[model samples]
Target chain A: MSILIDRNSKVLVQGITGRQGGFHARLMMEYGTNVVGGVTPGKGGEWFDGKPVFDTMRAAVKTKYADVSLVTVPARFAADAIMEAADAGIKLVICLTEHIPVADMMRVLAFCRQRGTRLIGPNCPGVMTPGEAKVGIIPAMVALPGDVGVVSKSGTLTYEVGFAMKNRGIGNSTIVGIGGDPVIGTTFVDILEMFENDPDTKKVALLGEIGGSAEIAAADYIKTSMTKPVAAFIAGRSAPPGKRMGHAGAIVDGGEGSADEKIQALEAAGARVAANPEEIPDLLS
Target chain B: MKLHEYQSKALFQEYGIPIPQGRVAETSREAGAIAAELGGTVVVKAQVHVGGRGKAGGVKVARDAAAAERHAQAILGMNIKGLTVEKVLIDEAADIQQEIYLAITNDRSAGQPLLMTSMQGGMDIEELNRTRPDAIIREHIDPILGLQPYQMTYIASAMRLPRAHWRSFLKILSGLYACYNKSDAELAEINPLVITGAGALLAVDGKVIIDDNALYRQPALTAQRDSSDEPESERLAREAGITYIKLEGQIGCMVNGAGLAMTTMDMTKLYGEAHGIGPANFLDIGGGATPEQVATALSIILSDANVKAVLFNIFGGITRCDEVARGILTAYNAVQPEVPMVIRLQGTNAAEGKKIISEAQLPHLISAETLTEAAQRAVAAVQESA
Candidate 1:
């Protein structure tokens, strides 16, 4: 019932010998993700957390038949790692690395698109199918299995919104962190389309922040197609103009990508917009 | 990461694109010397990161060295949109026959770099795009294939550029694309790609904004970063690996993650709006931040005298609550913050974190389980103190 991934998905961890990869690999495994193997270029033929380690994604996929990949490589090698995963026939790849060069991402995104492979993020928290499987860095305890599907452009905000939903006794079927980079792999429309088709997702929560027209475009999609009740929250309502609020993409440029613009767009699209995270549950209801 | 006009022109020159000879000068005397060397008429333009320098009288054409010095004196040390003009670019003026615009920027919706051109240039492109959208012709360049010659021809023809200027336009366009690609620039713009009276095409004004993430590979560009352009607290936060932005409010906020920090600000604003109070600052400790970094963030928040209360909202995933709690305690001892504090610790050893805060027995420190309650309490504390 989960979109993109579930407990049955065989996952391979790329750059598994690295600190971030190693830490998140264990966490994903602890959350019942089917992490079959890991790939660390020179550290092949080794074992990490009782899983096989290979030198390349080709070798890992051959041995474990991984359907998905969790890429935690450093920024410099993230694009290569993603392309390698996509080239190795991995249907889905989630990159958690941040600060990746934009040109590299452009190439990697093109490569993945050519192969019909879905890539999640290069600076994102990854995805979680609550109670089924977890990928990336979202804390496992914050999520629960339910009918609401959540998607956000931020990691911690995803956790905050999920926690808020959990507090209201509402859980999520799947939650996707699409990253906050200016040039990211997935868009709000892409995740919204996936959520709309998932049978278990009775309602959806779309969390966005300042910057980019993704929220506006998502509103258009929701207005035209989405039948599920969607509650939306846009952050940075009080943010000053022209200041980059931490995220590379979260900047107000040329009077575009402001919080007010996004809120108005989403509200006009018929989705209830929450003033804060606490109001998300009621808005969805 | 936005390069000044002189920097962008330097890159443009390196890529073999023609630009009016220019040199950056810090002092008005140096500007006059450069202007005298260039001879004839010269333009003294202020070097700042913001736009609308022309409207702010940051750009002026001087007919002689003395006039150039006067312009530099007027433009330099002048504050344009809150940014002080520390340097000015003195360049030999050109005889403009016509103006055209050329730029390369990422089109996020298309997921590719877009090369936009307009026959109407030398003015506000935003206003042009808004008023006459059809005047600007845009073509998305595949990052892998790059800016092909055919694509350039397509755009040039679409703009109905004269046959005589096509060759030079294509060369400049290619060079501009090269500058954008080689420099790792998110945006490379040549407003007023002027066709001179002497039948030469030159980039009159250039702008290149390097991708901050790609700066690691661009050592030269990274070195050109103007720290003076940023606020003191923002600079300190960057050094400490925290994300901080100053605001005009009474309640300071420190949270984990950019999204959460902004949400915390929004919540504070929502509850505090009625009380005529809001968050004083936006500070994100970032994921996996150390205790010392947290302490540094606290000190920075407390440094703001207008802050009547501080709110700490931590949802520990990679950031451990206990580590943050320890950092808070350390900062409390060091900064001796007089303002009332509301701390909400959740996720990852939150119980231990709460125990640490409670055991500290600081009268000003208050703990909450939810963001709503924490924001409400922080606003109420600020109101009561006021």
Candidate 2:
């Protein structure tokens, strides 16, 4: 029981002709994702990598019965793309694009909340269930089906945690990157709720970074709703103030979003904090 | 992007918020002329993207044109902390009978926009919150509803505003929110939203920081950036389309994996500061970084003036170790860096990749056993360079 995706989920690729979409589609197919079709307007009736192309999501979903869509369109068109996906009745959507305008996500998130569309990311590495289904850009080969369900905002850190889990022979049920954007579609709390209910997931390793109060909010949620054992690592412990580490949401404004504050909040909420990357493996045990 | 008071006030004016008449002047002569044109006393304040300017000798209240000119001369030419005082804002002085503060910023902890107002102003809000929490009022604004008129009215009335100034305060409060939303700001603050003795609400000082991710949509805000204040290496890295963050580590890191790159830095620190190398930088070439991109990342890492040794810690999954080895060899041939290098390649094609790197036989290129070994070798190389 992967939290969000499994082998039976049929997937459609938005902007299937784009470079990023084409590249990751091949990887997903190789990883055995049930990639049913591709969608790019004006490119209907064409094919790429053995997948049929349709002009609209509604047409592709109607013909192939696609239940999932991987969105790779630009930020300006992402909201419309999501709405189209919702109208087509795709239950799960993964947004692989980065730097989506917050206003666009604002409308998209509000719509998804009302319409019951589950979003995995807008700037994330996607979700993967080992030996089952994969969506997004996560390296499928490194993952294995196991008890730990991983979720993170940082891709590199997710890779680190996954590699550590692998080194310890502790497999992962699902690893979903909620993304590093301020207005991310999925939160740790959302994914934590899913993981808590999943029989396959006995534990969760959450990797967060400096910036934003998502960690603190997640802490509050974890205090009550979480049932699985949770281990977390918040990077940027020694990272200087004021400079954005990289992502737009990584700004250390007014000392509120510093790693120290996040660590304190998480510790208070009963999370075992991995102070650094090397310490993460120890926390997992 | 942080705008000075004058710029933010200009933005405030556009949103119909009432601000005192002000002009930014670069020189004392311009300041004197502006003060003279204003007909009387004016306040001269330095323009910097930081707070505590009043305590830092950057703000002065002058009685007349001569006093305003002197204060402007003192502020314009002086340096506050590390930032140069290049401009002074000249504005008509307000008779501040009461100082109230207001701001709107994303409170990540609350997972929404936060609206903070205080009867206590012109002081450290944090200290005030700790010492006298009741002096301030905080509200978590719903992202969907925003700060509605009724909420603003409630806060304004609770602050005990005079009946004469209530309408104006309401207008200014709405306008502030408009400015906050219009700029896509992460932070918008007015420290001294004063009620003048003459009973007029005045926004004396204000600041706004537009979100960097929203920069593509905010061309004016992006263009207002001062590149001079940025690190040279960081600027060059940005131009090259590489994600590089300068650090204090002695071992300069050029890695294909961002996660491994960070772990490399952490493990390097674990080995101790024998060479006092702060994290030289955080470079993420992203997944599927090509040999050319790898080579470019190498060149950028080597280009840092403080870098004495360069460490390549790559864990191949999607990024094949052989391709990363090829990149190192290519960058080595191109840049011909004289400093030492430690290469830690694992995962795909590790054996073949070792053979390829060893074949190059570059003088400074050293292969290590583990991340620990690589960090030690890099630190030793830095000492040798020193």
Which prediction has the highest TM-score against the true structure? 1
Could you give candidate 1's per-residue lDDT for residues A1-285 as a string of tens digits? 889999999999998888888998998998999999899999999999899999998888887888999999889888999999999999899999888888888888999999889999878999999999998999987878999999999988888778878878898999999998888889999999999999889999999999989999999999999999899999999899878888888888888999999999999999999997878988876
Clash pairs, model 1 backbone:
none
What C-alpha lDDT does candidate 1 achieve relative to the native structure? Answer: 0.91
Residues A93-117, candidate 2: write the lDDT tens digits: 8997776766556656767766788
Task: Return the TM-score for candidate 2, rounded to 2 decimals.
Answer: 0.92
> Evaluated on chain B only, what is the TM-score of candidate 2?
0.89
| Candidate 1 backbone clash number | 0
Chain A of candidate 1 gets a TM-score of 0.98
State the lDDT of candidate 1 residue by residue for B268-353, as single tens digits: 99999987999899898888776678778988998788999999999987677888899889888877888899999988789999
Cα error, candidate 2, residue B213 (Å): 2.4
All models: lDDT?
Answer: 0.91, 0.79
**lDDT per residue as tens, model 2, B25-62:** 99999999999998677899998877778899999998
